[model samples]
Target: MPDARGSSGRPRRGDRKLSGDRAGAALKVLQITDLHLRDDARPLIGVNTEATLIEVLDQAFASFTPDVVLATGDIAHDATLPTYLRFLQIIEQYHHGPKLCVPGNHDLIGPMIAARLPIDPLRVGNWVFVGLDSHVDDEVGSQVSDRDIAELVAACPPIGEKRHTLVATHHPPLEVNCPWLDKDRIQNASDLLESLARQTTVKGLVFGHAHQAVEGQSNGIGLFGTPSTCFQFEPESERFAIGDEQPGYRWLHLYDDGRIDSAVERVACSFEIDLTQRD
Candidate 1:
C-alpha cells in the first residue's frame, strides 16, 4: 500500500494507503461515472452501456492506471440489486486501486447498504476524497446535505499536510448551460459552495450524470463534470438531445502540494449510437 506522508514521511491516521502506487508520487485517480449498468441485455438509448464501459476501462487501464478509482453515480441504470452487485463485481475487476463511490438518483441507497457496498471517503497520502450523496429519492434534481460537508471538515483539515481535498458526488452543483439537463442539477449548490468556501482545504469538486464534460472554477475552487462511460447528452442544448461523442472517463493527478490536474479521455472504439433519441 502507498500512503501519502508528510515531509518527514510519517503516515497519518484514518488514511488508507493506496495499493500498487508509490509513496510521495502524485496520486493518480481515475473517475468513471454514469455507467448505467443493467442486469438485463438491453441497450440504453440505443447503445450497449456495458460494452462501452469495458472499452472505456480498457483504455483507462492501458493509458492511465490509477492509484484510486472513483465511481460518481448512476452506476446501475435499473436500480436493482443484481445490477448493483454486477457493478460491484465490475468495479472490483476494472481497477486494482482503491475504490470509493456515491449513489445517484437511479441508484437505490437502501439496496446498496443492504448489499454492504463501500460508500466512504478515501484518504490517500496528503488528500482525502469525500463522496457526497446528492441523490434525491424518486426525483430528477439533487441537493447536497450539509452533514456531508461537516464530516469532511472534521475528518480532513484545511491546512497543514492535509490541506487538499476532493469532493465527488453524483450531481453537479452548477448548471452546464444545457437547459434540459440543467433543470435536474443540484438545486442547493450555494450551500455546498459556502461550506467549501469556509473550509478552504477542499480544492475541487467532481461529479457524474450530466453526460457531458464541464470544467470551471468558483471561488478559487475547481468544478468539473465528467462525461459518461456510456452515451453522452448534447451540451448547451435547450432541449433533450443525444450526442455523437464517444464514451470516456476522467484522469486526475493529485499532487501532494494541493494541485489537481485532470482531463476527459474518450475510448478509442466505435459505438452503436442512436443520435436521434432525445429525452
Candidate 2:
C-alpha cells in the first residue's frame, strides 16, 4: 500500500513518487456517482446501470488512469447491505489508485454507522477530502449535520497554503435550478457555504445526486456536480423527469500550482436509447 508521500520527499497523488527532476506532477482524478444499483440485478430506466458503470470505469481507467477515484454518493438504490457490497466489489476491481466515497440518500446510513467506516474527512496529497452524510432516513430531503460541518472546517488545510481542498457529499449544497430537486437539496446549505466562505484553503466542492453535470462557483470556490453512471436528470427543466443524455463521469486534473481543470465525458457504448419512447 503506497502512501501519498513519494521517495523524493515531495507529495505525490498516491503511492507512486514523481521523478526527482520533474518540476511538478498533475493530480488526475475520476469522479463517478449515482449508481442506483439494485440487489435484484435489474436495470433502471431501460439501461443496465451496473453494466454501464462497469464499462464506464473500464473506459476511464484506459483513458485517464486517475490517481484517485471519488464516488460522490448514491451507490445503492435500496440501501441494502448486498447492494453496498456489490458496489464495493466493483470499485475494488476497476480502481488501481486510492478510492474515497461518500454515501447518498439511497444508501443505508445505519449500516455505515454500524460498520464504523470512519465518516470523517480524509487528507490526501495536497488536498483535503470531506465526506458528509446527507441522507435523512426515509425522507426525500437532505441535511448536513452540525457535527459534519465542524469536522469539515477542522479538516481544511492551513490558509495561504498551496494545497487544494474538495468537499464531497451526495446532495448539492445549492439550488440545481429544478424545483423538485432543489427542494431536496442539502438543508442548512447557507450555513455550509458561510463556513466555506471563511476558509481560504478550500479550493472546490464536488457532489452527486443531481445525475447531471453542473459547474458553478460558490464563495470563490469551484463547485461541480458529476453525472451519473446510471441515468441522467433533465437539466434546467421545470418538471421532475429523466433525460436521454448519455451516462458519463467527471475527470479532474489538478496542477501542482493550485490550478484545476475538469470536464465531463460521456461513456461510449455500442447502443443508444431513445428515452422518450413510450412503453
Candidate 3:
C-alpha cells in the first residue's frame, strides 16, 4: 500500500523497462502462487487452475507492470513434464519479465529443472531475491535443509554491505492460525528464523501453500503468505475448509531505502466449489 509508483505517478505498462540496477527507483514484484496447474486442464475443487491463473495474470499486469514475476509454488497439480512445460508456456505468454519459481509439495524438481525456470538469486539495485527450496520427499510438510540454511546465510550480505535480501519458499515459515494448514509449515523454521535474525540485511520472506493471505514478523524478518490462484482455504479454519475468497496474488514494492510494502489483490470473479470434497 506504500506508494510504489513513487512521485512520478504510475509508470505506463511499458513506460520504462525494468531490469538490472535502478538504485534510486522502487522495484515492483508480482507474486502468483499455488497455480495447481495440470496437463489435463482439470479443475481442483471446482476451480480451473489454468483459467484462474490466466485471469489473475491478466488482472495483475493490467494494473502495474512488474520488474519480476515470482511464482512461489504448486505450479503443477500433476508434477508431470508436460504440465511443467505447459505452465511455463502459459506464464511466458502473459509476461516477459524475469520468472522465478520455488517448488511446492505437489511439484517435482526434476521436471521443474528440466523446464529451466530461474531459481537463482537475482539482484536489482541493492536488493537480492533468493528462492529457497523447502520440498521434502514424500511428505506434505516441509523443512529447510541444513545446506540450504548455510547457503542462505552465505547469500545475505553483511550488515554494512549495503545489500538487502528477500527470500522466497513454497511453505510458510510462520503459523497462519489455520491449524490444518499450519501443520504443513516449515518444520525447521526456527533454523531459518535464527539464521535470518543474525543477518541484518535480510528483510523479508515470501511464501505460499497456505492458500491464504498472511503477514507477520518473526525474529525481525517479515513474513508474507500469498493466496492461491485457485480456491482458497479458510484462513482461521481448524480443519480443511474452503473459503469464499476469490483467486488472488500479492504485489511487493521494494524500495531503494530498505523499505518493503505489499498487499494482496483478489480477482473480481469467484468460483462455486463443492464443500463435500475436502482434501
Candidate 4:
C-alpha cells in the first residue's frame, strides 16, 4: 500500500508536506447520502427530508468537523436546479470544506452540473477521492460506462505514488443483501472491481442508495454503504421496507498511513417514519 509520506518522511497531500501536528492528523470525511431533497418541503413517508437532513448535519457537526463533505447521491428528489441549490445552501451552513457528490437514480446530471457540485477527483491529505457517475437514464439500476472506467484508471496515482484512492458513486458495486436494492447494483460491478484491482493505490469504495448501513471487504478493499439522511430501508429484506431507524450519516477518518476508520451516527431526535407507507 502506498502511504501518504513523502521522501522527506512527512505526511503529504500531492507532493505538499503537511505542516505541524496537522501533518500527522487524520483527515476527517463526513459522508451524507440519499438526501432526496425536493423542490417543495415535502416529507418522504412521515419524515420531512430537508428537516431530517438539517438534523443529521447538526448532529454530524456537533461531534466532529470534517475536512470534506461527501454527498454520495440522490441530492435532489425533484432533480431541479432549485432543489440542488437549496441542498447546497443547507450544506454550506454546516460544512465549508470540499462538497463532493455523484448523481443517483433520482438525480439529473444537468441540474447537478448547473449547481456546480463537483464530481471530480479531489486530493485531500493522503487520499484521492474519485467520484463516478453510475446513473443510467430511465432506470433504477446503475452501471459504470467503459469511459468512466478508463477515466477512473487514469485518475489513479501511478504505482510509485504515495496517495491512496477512494471511489464514490451513487450505486453499490457490491451487494448489500437487500434483494430489491441489490437488483440496482452496478450492472458491470465485476468490471469495476477488476479495474480497481489493477490499480495498486486504490484502497476503498463508498456508495449510497442502499439507504442502510453496510460494511464489507471485496478484493482487499474496504466497502462502505451509508444510511440515508432522511429515511432508511430495512436491511437484508427480500422486498422494499422502511426501517424505524433514525436518519443518519457516516464519518471516515483517513489517516496518512493508508488506514481508514469510520462509523455511522444517527440524529438524537426521533422522526416517526411511516413504515407502512411505501413511496
What's the lDDT for all of these models? 0.76, 0.72, 0.80, 0.80
Q: TM-score per candidate, in order? A: 0.86, 0.83, 0.88, 0.88
Per-residue C-alpha lDDT of model 1 across residues 171-223, encoded as one tens digit per residue: 87777777788787877677667677676588888898888887666666677
Clashing pairs in 3: none
The TM-score obtained by model 4 is 0.88
Residue by residue across 20-105, what tens digits does model 4's lDDT show?
34323788898999999989866667778898899999888997788988999998788999999999899999877876799999
Local accuracy of candidate 2 as per-residue lDDT tens digits, 204-255: 7778888887766656676778789977888767787887677888877776
Model 2 bad stretches (over 4 Å):
1-24, 113-120, 270-279
Which regions of candidate 1 deviate over 4 angstroms? 1-24, 274-279
Error of 1 at 138 (Å): 1.8
Taking the candidates one at a time, how many backbone clashes does each contain?
Answer: 1, 0, 0, 0
Candidate 3, 163-255: lDDT as tens digits? 888888999886777789878888788877788768658888899998888777676677778889998887678998888888899888888
Better of 1 and 4 by TM-score: 4
Q: Which residue pairs come into collision in candidate 1?
A: 4-125
User: Of the pair 1 and 2, which is ahead by TM-score?
Assistant: 1
Query: Which candidate order results from sorting by TM-score in descending order?
Result: 4, 3, 1, 2
Candidate 4, run of 10 with poorest lDDT? 10-19
TM-score (C-alpha, index-matched) for candidate 3 = 0.88
